[model samples]
Target: MTALAVRQIGPPRLTKGLESAGRLDWDAHRALHPHPRPLTTDQLIALCEAGSLHGRGGAAFPFARKVKATADSAVRRRKRTVVVVNGTEGEPGSAKDKTLLRGAPHLILDGAALAATALGSLEIIVAVTDPDAAASVQRAIAERGLGARARVVRLPERFITGEGGALVRGINGGRPIPPGRKSRASTRGVDGLPTLLSNAETYAQLAVLAGLGPHRYRKVGLPQEPGTVLLTVTGSARFPAVVETAAGAPLGHLLDLCGSRAGEGVLVGGYHGAWLKGEVATRTQVSRAGLAAAGGALGAGIVMPLGRGTCPLGECARVARYLAAESAGQCGPCRLGLPDLAGALTALASGQDAAAARDTVARAARMVTGRGACAHPDGTARFVLSAMDAFEDDIARHVADGGCGRPVLGVLPAATDARLSLEVDWSRCDGHGLCADVLRGTVRMDEYDYPVIPSEPIPARLEADARRAVAACPGLALRLVPRTAHDKPRPEPQRGR
Candidate 1:
């Protein structure tokens, strides 16, 4: 909610022709990017395919393929196609989308309008969780006289609420969680219409790609990833800014530009992304393929340098605990397994006979992978497992004598538990076993057939089932309660001298 100074680096395609003078208003944006070329569906798809444009969202899916699928589905179903610009920016430590939306709102609106027009749709929805971003977008829409074509909808600031299907469900007045079954928003989204949903940055890139075409757009970045990427550079850096860099820019170069020194490690992507050691960081490239080769990902365009002096293992444990709490509680493996993994990591961090705990963490990470309704469990597994490999020596030292003698600086960010958590009133409870049956992992039966919950906070994944159990409770015992502010972790400790 605070005002963040967003600065760019490299040639700056998406954020091109702008300076830190201030937010680029509608008139300035129109002047900079004059008369964007309007393209039909086929023309847009051809340009995207030629440029090999990919989603800036964590998945890195082929953008052209999504367009083709949505267009084809729309034609076949005789349904209107829709465009949803995702500005949820739910990934912690990532602020590029918000930066783009807030700084250059017109650019995002142009891209969304382009997509909607190309797909023969008249509707575009820009979903944002940040109040400032929403206000900026609304003002841009009004100024551009795009009131008929596009609208901005504010969403609850939660991690999972940003997901494509979950956002669609929320927009359509359903609970903001992915449906139990696997379904693409392209096939059914936003009032059962075929929808083309993508990250807000992706749409901004679309606007750029539309103007530049395939040739000029391919000039700066790699051939594989032929465009610039916006990265939110943070963690132990002298200057934390939203950086725009070419796709193939060396990871270490960005680190140096962000004021990172030698001996520092980098967490490529975001929390669910991998942590590469300093040596690996130098060799790593900013593109997806390059990062893949370096055992990392260009996820959500987040590049965080882990400076010297902090404990990588301790930081991993803290992030793991936060990830466990953010689970949508839709699947058993994620709802139960993540907390177990976090517990194991916590034991390891505290130096409490950690070898067994380390093994437990590893096994739990593997067990939870590919078992969730969404990619949350799988991505989280990758994050935890990668920490194990990246910090192998630290794990070894901790297991040998309990710890590596370093403090957790909390470099990674996570949302505090601000939502309502399920609560039980003892006077209203009548030892109903139904709550335990419906919410198996969350509600356990006590000796008297009453539900006994652990002191740990319940994850969002289990919230739906918890509500179901509450409704099933004949005694009207269960209710949702806001967690205490004290439950939040302390402010991040300062790193470096």
Candidate 2:
């Protein structure tokens, strides 16, 4: 894990003492934020409504509506309501939630306690993927004597594990992947009871709201979306820090604070986000409404401006491949369409049949939208389509010529685990052609029908198929192995004749 830099653009609220050191103790946290009077369920809902509090998770759903839905479900179902705190910060480019979970666990707990108490709920579950965050939250729960009422659960580290329904399923001891079905967490969650599930930052904001009330909280940010927001600044940023700022702050100012030049373009949100031209990103504001107006989103509060050192199209293609690999594999759009979309984008980025690749990318994106069980396909489509729009000039150059003249420096981050290749045990081989049959793109059969594995790392689109090939080998001769320095780099797809 990278050492995160913490900074505040304005008067610090959530990140007040975060820069100083390790996790803040309960006493120190209380000293900074004296406990306010406990809010009733209605008061809490009213504060959220007035403040326009939204989930810090990618969706930016209204917190008040989610709360009311959970409360209503609990009343109607005659079951105890469960409060779930999602600290699973699965976005590779975002670290805001982890910063909050590790630095100010108490604040999150305070918010969760308020909701759980008001909802007449007995259980408060904090689900986190980072070990440090889990430990910090566990210590905070112990310090507050919330052992009986609150507990911390460590979930698997995956891009989609943080989805509300997925987190609920994981907490119920199932695989932490999207269920491929739309089910509200409010109605059926954690032991089949009504649940109030929200992002870690959302709950932390509630704690702040409880302390300052809606009027004071509205003083700092825009009138429409009051209060501060936490953002993870990456890519060309000099600081690459988790920044706390007013919700409607200028995007350019944040870029300047992080020492970004906005070289080629800026990616707002995360992998499942859109790209904005440099000038457009500079003029945009760091709010949902503002970003939406600029053809982007404030999803998960991630802002990454591309630097000139790398090829922008290549970086987008890299992340597109990663998003495709991270799919839940539960629906056809995610399992099949996303990989196809990624391959097309990769081909376009490689300057291979640029016009056709672009068309394929656009077509695949359209085919997958709104067809998945979750928003994975839609978000991935948004990311790829936005890249096509934002990098049109570069695509034209790549089409006219065969190169971008810039190396793919890999400025955009993705999971390191995706660097894998296939190996074969020749001694155990029975000339089975299953591997070639499954991995049609990367594997081929020799004259004797023996599998001929490529030395280069498997392409992201073929990783799942590679695994299936390994499993399907009759002689158990094939295995998936991590690519090392000795392995050859992934070869670019063949260009059009």
Residue pairs in collision within model 2 = none
Number of clashes recorded per candidate: 4, 0
Name the weakest run of 10 consecutive residues (lDDT summed) in model 1: 488-497
Which regions in candidate 1 have their CA more than 4 angstroms from the true location?
1-3, 262-264, 419-488, 491-497
Each candidate: RMSD: 5.9, 4.3
Candidate maximizing TM-score: 2
Q: Give lDDT tens digits, candidate 1, residues 375-464.
A: 888888888888888788888878886677766666666554445566788998988688877765445564356775433355555667
Cα displacement (Å) at residue 272, model 1: 2.0
Who wins the lDDT comparison? 2
lDDT of 2 by residue, 228-260 (tens): 989999987887999999988999999999989
